[model samples]
Every structure is written in C-alpha cells, then in structure tokens.
Target: MTKDELKQRICESVDRRRSQIEGIGDQIMVNPELGFKEFETAKLVANTMEEFGFQTETGLARTGVKAVLKGKNPGPTVALIGELDSLGVADHPMVNPETGAAHACGHNAQIAGLMGAMMAIADTQAGEELAGNVVFLAVPAEEYVEVEFRRDLVKGGEITLLGGKCELIKQGHFDDIDVAMMIHTHSDSTMKKTGVSTSSNGFVSKLIRFVGRAAHSGGSPHLGINALNAAQIAINAMHAQRETFRDSDAIRVHPIITKGGDIVNVVPAEVTMETYVRGRTKEAILDANAKVDRALRAGAMAVGAKVEIETLPGYMPLANDATMVDMFEQNSEELFGEDELTKVGHRTGSTDMGDVSHLIPAIHPMMAGASGPGHSRDWHISDKEMGYLGPAKSLAMMAVDLLYGDAEGAKAVMENHDPLMSKEEYLAFQEGVFRTEVYDGETGTSEVES
Candidate 1:
C-alpha cells in the first residue's frame, strides 16, 4: 500500500466515526475538569485508547494518561498529544455544574481530535506498510496552574513539576519519542493551520509577601505600618517600569495582589501577591524579574518593612524546529488541501510545550473550532459547519503524515532539528532561576529575581 492510500484510508476510517468523536468532545465539554484535576476526563480518554488496543499507563505526571501502539515494523516513534484539562472559565455557558469549570479554551475539542487519530490509526489495515511506532498521549495541567498549589503536589509526592508536559518529559514518559505534535483548538476562523513560533516567552512565577505591624485602624492607626500600603507602592513601582521594559523582546510583567491584609478596620500585618514575569527570551524574562525584585525591595525599604520572595521556573519560550515545521506544513497541505492548511495570524500565547521544544524537535499548531473571542465566556462551538470535524481531521491527518507519510517529511524534520540547550545545561539554568529568599502567603513580597 502507498503512503497516500494509507493516509486516505485513515481519514476515511476516522470520518466514519465522526459522530463518536463529536460525542466524545461534547461529553468532555459538558463535564469540564480543571488542570491537574482531570480525573474523569482522563478516564474517558484512556477508555477510548484501551478500546483501540493500546497498552496504557495511568498516574503519569500526576493524573496523565499514556498509551503506546506498536506498528507491524519498527521505525521512528511519533507521538500525538492532547491536553486533558480545561480552564477556570466559570461564567461560560457550557460550564460543568459539579466542577464549575468550562471548556472555554477548547481542550475538549483537542481530546476528541486526538481520540479520532488514535482510533483510526489503531484500526488501520495499512500498518504493515507504515514506518515506525505511534504513541498517543493525554497530558494534564498544560494550563500552568499556580506555583504554590503545584508545589504542594510535588511536596506530597503526587507529582514533581508544574507544567503537565514538562513533568512528563522529566519523568521519562517521552524519552524514546522521536517527534512530538500538539494541536491547540482555538475559537477563531474556519481554517485548519499549523503555527511556528520563532520565539516564545518564558515564565517565572513568584509569591510576594510583606510584613508590617497590625493595630486597630480607628484606635491606633498611627502605630501601624500598613502592609497593604506597601504592596500598593510596590505595584505602582512595577507599573512605572513599563516604559523601561523593552517592547522588542515583548517583556510583560503583571502582578496581582492576592491578599491585601486582614480586616480593613485593623492595619493588616501581612499581604501576599502573585505575579508572572514573561519575555520572549529567558534572558529578557530574567532581566525583567530582576527589576521586579528591586521594586519589591524598594517598597519594603520605604515602608520600613520586610519582604519575602519565593520563585519557580514556570516555563521556557517555545522555539520551533525549522525542519519539523516545514514537514508539518507539507503534510498538512497534502491531507487537508492547500486551502485548509495555512499559517496562523495575530496570535500570542504561551505553553508548556515550549519546555519540550527546548529538549527535542517539536511542533505546536493552532486549529479553529469555534467563532468569536477565544478564552472568554462568549466562546462557543459552532457545530453547523463541522468546524470541529475539520480541525480534528487535520490533526488525525497530521499524525498519519508523521507515521506513514513519505519518509522525506520525517527525514527533513529530523535533519533540521537542533537543541537550544543540552538537558544538563537547561536544568542548571532552571535551578539558578528558581531561587527565592522569602515566601509568606500573607505578605505580597515574593518576586522573581534575575
């Protein structure tokens, strides 16, 4: 059997089960689960994988699902990933009643698309003609949940990292995989496209704490050094530095004062704040964080108070492997037609996938699934035009391309691959970045340092 024939066969097989795949998406949308807490969602996806005859592993990276399917012959191993967690978009019309979570980010669609590919390839009679191995992965916590919560999980031995796919990579879950593909569904246009980010921002998470003396507001206001006041001062300083931030690197520093103080009547003794330092490059992120730290310390000095900072390496910027992206583009056009596969436009977002991209050759593509603004309450799936099916088909076809498409595609992707930093080098950089002096929940003094 020819590669084109095999591709056609897989698409047809998945097309026949379109209804089942759509049902899976709808079910997950209705029962949305938050990042790192996708118990039911994981089970649902895992069950489907098992039905397809893939040997599965559960509880990876804390509630992740992994399945491996061996081909008729040994070749390169290609992996397809579907994120299993939803965002905390509570007001969304499709919010799950029990969990108060919603699929506003279109993760449900991603899962369904992954399922379609897994099932189709598993049932493909052309496996004898295909090359290498295929692995379908369902990852948890791609959402990058807060550091403190994730740290707790790590401390309790539930998991050792924050970002879902990063945790998996660290756990040797994908050590043998030669290629990785992630399809993120957005509620944008009708196009099915793949995007290559020349540069993506890295994130440094911090918890800021401020300490001050508390006294009755009305009776002894003069005796108190309001920690809340100090926090506001620190935030003001951060805002003022916006002008100094280099726009070329897309440096972004946003902070939220999570806890101002106790009762308003009494001068609060402590205030805690959470913040993210983002930049197009790790150096830019680190530089911006250094300025942030200086501001926090300045605030503490002005108020005659002390500040504490706790930091963690959130994620690294995503840099596409040139060869991998070129291969994806060619395969996309072949399976979906030139019209269907296009480049993304005016989009800016970050992902833990960046972490993997740093370690190995990877591709993250954007596919449309709905209309209107994405990541908002107004985000809704438009099933009329098979908006959902087109993207799902595109993703399934991408897998087919990687596993069975002309060997030239895989060869090109592999040839152009280069690691920005070695595993040891990257780990050393992260260890140096995830440093902090203080971490108090009440005082907003934690800051990501250079």
Candidate 2:
C-alpha cells in the first residue's frame, strides 16, 4: 500500500474507535492527578497498551509507562509521547476535590491522542508495512510543581531530578529512541486548527530562604531583624534588573513569596520565595540567574540577615527538528488543509520536551481543541473532534510517513539534525546546575558549592 493509503486506513481506524478514545480522555480529565503521582493514569495507559498487544514497561521515572510496537523490518525507533500529569488548579471545575489536581493543561488530550494513534496503527497492522519500531510513552511530572516535595524526594534518593523527562533521561529511558513527537493542546483562538513552533524557552528553578532574629514587635522592635523586609528588598532588586534583560533573549523571571510571617505580634524570623529564570538560550538563562543571585545577596546584606539559596535544574530550551517539523506540517496540512495550519515562532513557555529535543530529533507541536487561557481554571476541551481526533490522525499519519518505505523519512531527519549536546554533556550540565549557597552579611562570610 502507498503511504497515503496507509494513512487513510489509520485515520479510518481512529474514527472507528472515536468513542473509546474520547472516553479515555474524559476519564482522565475527571480523575486528574498531580505530577510524580499519576499512578492511576499510568495504570490505565499500561493496561490499554497491553490490550493492544504491545510489550509494556512500568514504573519509569516513578510513574511513566512505555510500550513498544515492533515493525517487520529493522530500522530507527520513533516514540510517541504523552505526559501523564496535571496542575494544582484548585478552582478548576474538573479539579479533584481532595488533591486539587486538574487537567487544566489538556494533558488528558495528549494521552487520548496517543492511545488513539496506537489503536489505529495496531488495528490496521501498519507496522507490517513499515521499516521502524514505534514506542508509546506516558511520562510523568511535566508541570514541575510541588518543589518542596520533589526536593524531599531528592534528599531521600527517591529521584535525582524534578522533571519527569529529566529523570527519565538520567535513567536511560529515552536512550533507545532516535526520534520523538508529541502534540500539546493550545487555547489561543487566533491560531489555526493546528500549529508548530520553531522553539521555546527553558528555565532553572530556585528556592530561597531569608533568616533573621525574632523578637517582640511592640516593645523591642530594635532587637529584631526583619526577614520579610529583606525579601521585599530582594524582590525590588530583581525588578531593578529587568531593564538589563535583552528583548532578544526572551527572559522571564517571576517570584512569589510562599511565606511572609508566622504571626501578627512577633517579628518574622524566616521568609521563603520560589521562582524560575527562563530564557531562549542556556547562556541567557545563566546570565539572568547570576543577576538574580546577586540581587538576593544584596537583600541579605542590606538587612544584615543571612540568606540561603537553592538552585535546581529545570527544562532546557526547545529547538524543534526542522525535518520532523516538515513531515508534521505536511501531515497536518493534508488532514486539516493549508488554511487550517499555522506556523508559530518562538514561545516564551517551557517544557521538558525541550530537554529531549536537545539530545535527539524531536517535535512538540500544538493542536487546537480547547478554550480559555492555558493552565487557568477556565481552560477545557470544547471541541472533541478537533481536540482528540485531530492529533490522533495527525500523529498516526506522521508515524506512517516517517517509518514507511525503508524508513527514508526518519533517516533524512537524523541526517539533517545536529544535536545541541551529547547525552554525557547534557547530564553534566544539568547536574552542575544543582547548587546551594549561604550568605551572611554580618560575618561577611559565604558558602557556595555545586
């Protein structure tokens, strides 16, 4: 069969399983679980993959599941990835009341689309006509939340990295796959039915603490040192550096104070803050991070308080593979028409997929099916056909295009691609980002190490 014929068959197959696919998506949406805690979701994916006759592996990166569908011929291995996590949007209509987990980011759609593609390809035996293997992966903790909990996990040696993909890379889960693709749901109505971005920002996570002497607020205010004041100074200093950030770098730094004080009567002894420094390139992100650190130290120095700063590795900047983008674009246009396709430029947001794109050929595109601002309580899947089936058909078609006919398409993508970093270099760089520092103003002493 020709490539188009195979794609048609796959789409027809997906259509035949429309109810099942939508059911899976709806089920996941209503039962949302937070990152690193998606046991039920992972179980669902594993069971579905097993039902479809794929070899399954579970408990990867804590809650990830992987299943492989081997082709008749030996060639490249391509992975179709779906994130298995949700955000802590307590106000969302579909949020899990107890856990405050909600599928505000539309990851449920990603899983559904992944399963839809799997059902279509397996049911039609498309692998028999292809030259490469296909892997279905449901990964965990893409949102990068619950920092304190994740840090506790690290301290206990339960995991080394906060992001799921980062941990998976450290555990060698992605080592076997040569090419990867995943579709994310977007909320922008101005965009077409489907869109592909050229690149996106990456970020480094930070946790900060300010310590000072506590005393009576009414009688002996002079005996107390205000940690909250130091935090305020630090925030102002961070704002002062905004003018120095280059527009071309697309830098973003937003910090929030998690704890301000303990009581109304006593002087606060400790204050805490969390933030991320995001930029379009590694150099830019590191430069901004240094500025932030200096500002934090300045705050401590001004108030004669001690400050401890913890830095953790976050997602890397995403650079989509040009050849993979072309194949995805073609398939998108074929399914949704050229007018319904949009080409996006650089996005300011970040994803762990960006980390994957740096080491191998990968594409992270967006499909429209939802309404309201992304990650907001109002966000939801309004168009099931476009939300669930559009990506299903697009991914299935792209799989056929890449793996069919001696795997020429996959080879071309790899040939045209040059990785930003090797696996060793990538691991070293991320590990180096893990550091902690304590600066004491009164003693004029500092402790810094990575």
* Least well predicted 10-residue stretch by lDDT in candidate 2: 332-341
TM-scores of all predicted structures: 0.91, 0.99
The global Cα lDDT (0 to 1) of model 1 is 0.75
Superposed model 2: Cα runs more than 4 Å off: none
Can you write out model 1's per-residue Cα lDDT over 68-154, one digit (the tens) per residue? Answer: 776666677777888899877768888877766787777888888888878777677545665677678899988765567787886
In angstroms, how far off is 309's CA in candidate 2? 0.2
Q: What tens digits encode model 2's per-residue C-alpha lDDT throughout 1-450?
A: 898899999999999999999999999999999999999999999999999888899999899999988888999999999999999998999989999999999899999999999999999999998998999999999998999999899989989889999999999999999999999998898899888889999999999999998989998878998899999999999999999999999999999999998997888889999999999999999999999999999899998999999999999999999999888888888888877778889999999999999999999999999999998999999999988998888888888888998999999999999999999999999999999999996786889988
Cα lDDT over the full model 2: 0.93
Separate clash counts for every candidate? 20, 0
lDDT (Cα atoms) of all candidates against the true structure:
0.75, 0.93
Go through the candidates in order and give the C-alpha RMSD of each one to the true structure: 3.2, 0.8
